[model samples]
Target: MPERGARDLSPGTQARFDRFSPTGPKTSLLTVPGAVGAEVAGFTPVGDVMGCVVHQVGYTETSTWSADRIGQLADILRAGYQTALDRLVEEATAIGAHGVLGIDFTITSPDGLVQEFVALGTAVRATAGPRPRRPFTTGLPGQDVAKLMLAGWVPVRVAVGISGRAFTDRWGRPMVNEWVGNIEVPMATELATAVRTAARAEFTREIGDCGADGGIVSDLKFDLWPVHDVAVAAMATVIGTAITRFREGPVAPTSTLKILPLTRI
Candidate 1:
């Protein structure tokens, strides 16, 4: 009888690879200082803290399945995690945060299919001196910044719009219909300027109306449509939190602040 070919151990071996593993050394954990309950216990006033969120490019089910077939699903998932982490880090850097605490991650799917990957964290300046090792707990009625940390969440909305037209410029190149052959300035410039101005105003107005301190502008989309005429339409959005500061009571010594696991409490 012909010798049987070597059995395929790849599938069996590959199954083990699907398990999730920590991307890097767990030495980089961060947490917000102060007792979450203190804000509500009349111990300390709630201060405004900058927040930011970031998402990774979504992968289709097909891509994910294919990665599994190639025994690369772990790498793909890790890549997604890193992408989100990097985005949060970039935002923290922009805010001049010494360290980010209460970091969280979340995975969302609108139709039961993985639709988005998100990362979020509070950007805060750490108190000077050696950091405390554990979180203290106290009684409060306000949101617990530590417990409310979400890993995968989309940011609040800010609106943006862009518009443009195509015609031939003074240079004889095809451009917006109304413009002469390739004019010195592109016709789209006018529409762009108008839309940009409107977008900024709208963002400011929205934030003010919502009682938010500030918002992060992102995913500003610009689209050029050739409908009826070569008119362009652009859209953009901002994501952030509407924060309200409140003073509870006098700050206390030996305030017990509890750092709960990152999740909705």
Candidate 2:
């Protein structure tokens, strides 16, 4: 598996790895305060890293777009995100970093059918203590990472959930009345709810897959557009960092902020 992972790296990425030296000066994307906070938490910034992928989406059937089609769309999106993230992790590993922090994702569709996903972050190495088998990844800022350590928890990885849907069934055909007065559309409401629920479920599954105790949701996004002027297509995304307990017993609270289950929104 490790060999396969290494083989998957692009030539450019491999060159980046070959040029990296542990004793050389490093670049970082963190602010001064963020760097200080990470240092206080026993980590030293190694370098800035990025990973990206461009995907082409194609539909097998060209009839009316439905929820089933949306499922395939979501699958393609999920693959793009995972591949990009995996490359990001590989870069961190090549640089000898124990983790990547303050990670952020960007997605853009240049055309109607082609999408690009990119992940960026600052890689860090532990100044002391044991490291995990694989480098951890997180979207938390440096200060937040420090606070989490003080609270006896450590970030595992970034978790993502995405779901897309289109409404074209019996309940959705009436939303296009040209002469009807403006009013709330039940079909739209249902579509939103369904997509959100599916996305959240996927997020939970991601957390579980990483063997984390729970997750801390960092963002939620939704997009909707009219499909052929007869149906509406919607996509929902949830992003968060999965975390696990490091200390056996309860630790002192880092702040007065409530410490409810991070998995719960």
Candidate 3:
């Protein structure tokens, strides 16, 4: 049993726990300009950790009218990204880290059929006490983590959402009550609605898996293009770190009084 404090750890989680954790009790001397040391806020940097995965992209046929043609691509992406995330967690856990901060994710298409995903971050542990059985991952920098801790909240993990979209463009006719000769372009209202719906649905599902009650979001991105000239594809990817609120917002900093220098009498 590691002395770590990941509460609510299930039997499955414990089974996978390392039988032992080596004790170094070392401090990270690495410094960032304008950033406070981890020790000042009761944390110790374990090391810089990373994880990566490469997945082959399946070929998809194009269709001008059907959007479901590329739904399977979404599933493939989901699996690939999730694998990368899992590997990242394993690395952080191996270091006996309580959480990861300043996480960076990278995506590259090594070839037409193969894509790679990489996760990188600095791992750290709380010095004041044991951390949760499972450490959290975040894109937040070390300074932000320290500041948030003072406010009574801890980052959980990085959440990701991805959705595959396809659309067709064909202004078949005008779609407005023209004042005699109205020439308003028809709105792709359904396409717009579908885009939001699918992307958000994918994002919501990804965050749900992290068990985060509430958190911040960022890096929501999209890649849209037409392949084979018959169908348009929209690939939306959103990234952010999830957080768990502490019992209360950060405690108010204790006040200190410094008597002004006495006037020379």
Candidate 4:
């Protein structure tokens, strides 16, 4: 077995675990309704946890890049995001959390080559039932988690996938117009479609890696722009939570109402 503190946690984070206590005061990032929802689902909030990583990306320019080169850039960025999530899981383990809920990611790019990735969530413990060997994670809110559990599905992990593609004009090809007539940019459209397809494939692979049945996509973002005078580049990212069924077949609905209001009027 690997040593407990041998993970890549920072010095401060490691030290925090050194003085950890199970009975200490706890904290949570959930809203009041979220807290109640979690309680109803038989999960008790342990604490609010966070992980962060700042990395310097290697790719210098998108202008001269091919699809493969853009993919390499995405690989580097994916590493940063994975590292941040790993650290977050480590923190959750320190607090004996069975899982983390309502996870959110914050990414800031100071420049073209530097980025900081942060993951934040509320750690929780199952009030009853067998605990997992490693903590599970999800981007869904506590209320959504409760709903999922009631439906016999359980959150497995946060799934993320990113893909990038670059399209460039060949030699002697006519340059695409800059805000000219209403013309379809075939190259750009193809690049965008390719990136999105690859990103979703990657997202599905993430779910496979978790041994989950499927995933719930919460966010899909695409960034497309012109690079240099002859190239168009696109980057796509998909974020969601992988989930597995705990009980086979359809589950009975928890409420009969079609719409449940959050507040009493």
Candidate 2: list runs displaced more than 4 Å. Answer: 1-8, 248-265
User: What are the TM-scores, per candidate, against the unseen true structure?
Assistant: 0.28, 0.86, 0.70, 0.86
Q: Give all candidates' CA lDDT scores.
A: 0.37, 0.85, 0.65, 0.84
By TM-score rank, best first, the candidates go 2, 4, 3, 1
Candidate 2 has its poorest 10 consecutive residues by lDDT at 1-10
Clashes of each: 26, 0, 7, 0
Query: For candidate 2, lDDT tens digit of each residue in 1-265?
Result: 0233535568867776666666788888888888988998899988888888998888666574665677788888899888889999988987778999999999899787888999999999998999887899999889889988987899999999999989875653655676887876677889999999999999999999989999999999998776766678899999999999988646666788568787876
Question: What's the true lDDT of residue 217 in model 2?
Answer: 97
CA RMSD per model (angstroms): 18.4, 6.1, 8.1, 4.2
TM-score of 4: 0.86
Which regions of candidate 3 fall more than 4 Å away from where they truly are?
1-37, 62-69, 169-193, 227-230, 250-265
Give the range where candidate 4 is weakest over 10 consecutive residues by summed lDDT: 1-10
Model 4 lDDT tens row, 228-265:
66777788999999999998647576778768688844
Ranking by lDDT: 2, 4, 3, 1
Residue 162 shift from truth in candidate 4, angstroms = 1.2
Better of 2 and 3 by TM-score: 2
Model 3, 1-265: lDDT tens digits are 2344554433433443433345534333235821364555576677666677788776554433245545666776777767777776776676578877777777788566787888777667787765687878888777777777777777877877777766554543323334648452223344445665677776677667767667677677766555444445666767787776766874575985567556833
Pairing residues by index, what is the TM-score of model 1?
Answer: 0.28
**Model 4 regions more than 4 Å off:** 1-9, 15-20, 59-63, 66-69, 172-175, 249-265
> After superposing candidate 1, which stretches have Cα over 4 Å from the reference?
1-186, 213-229, 238-265
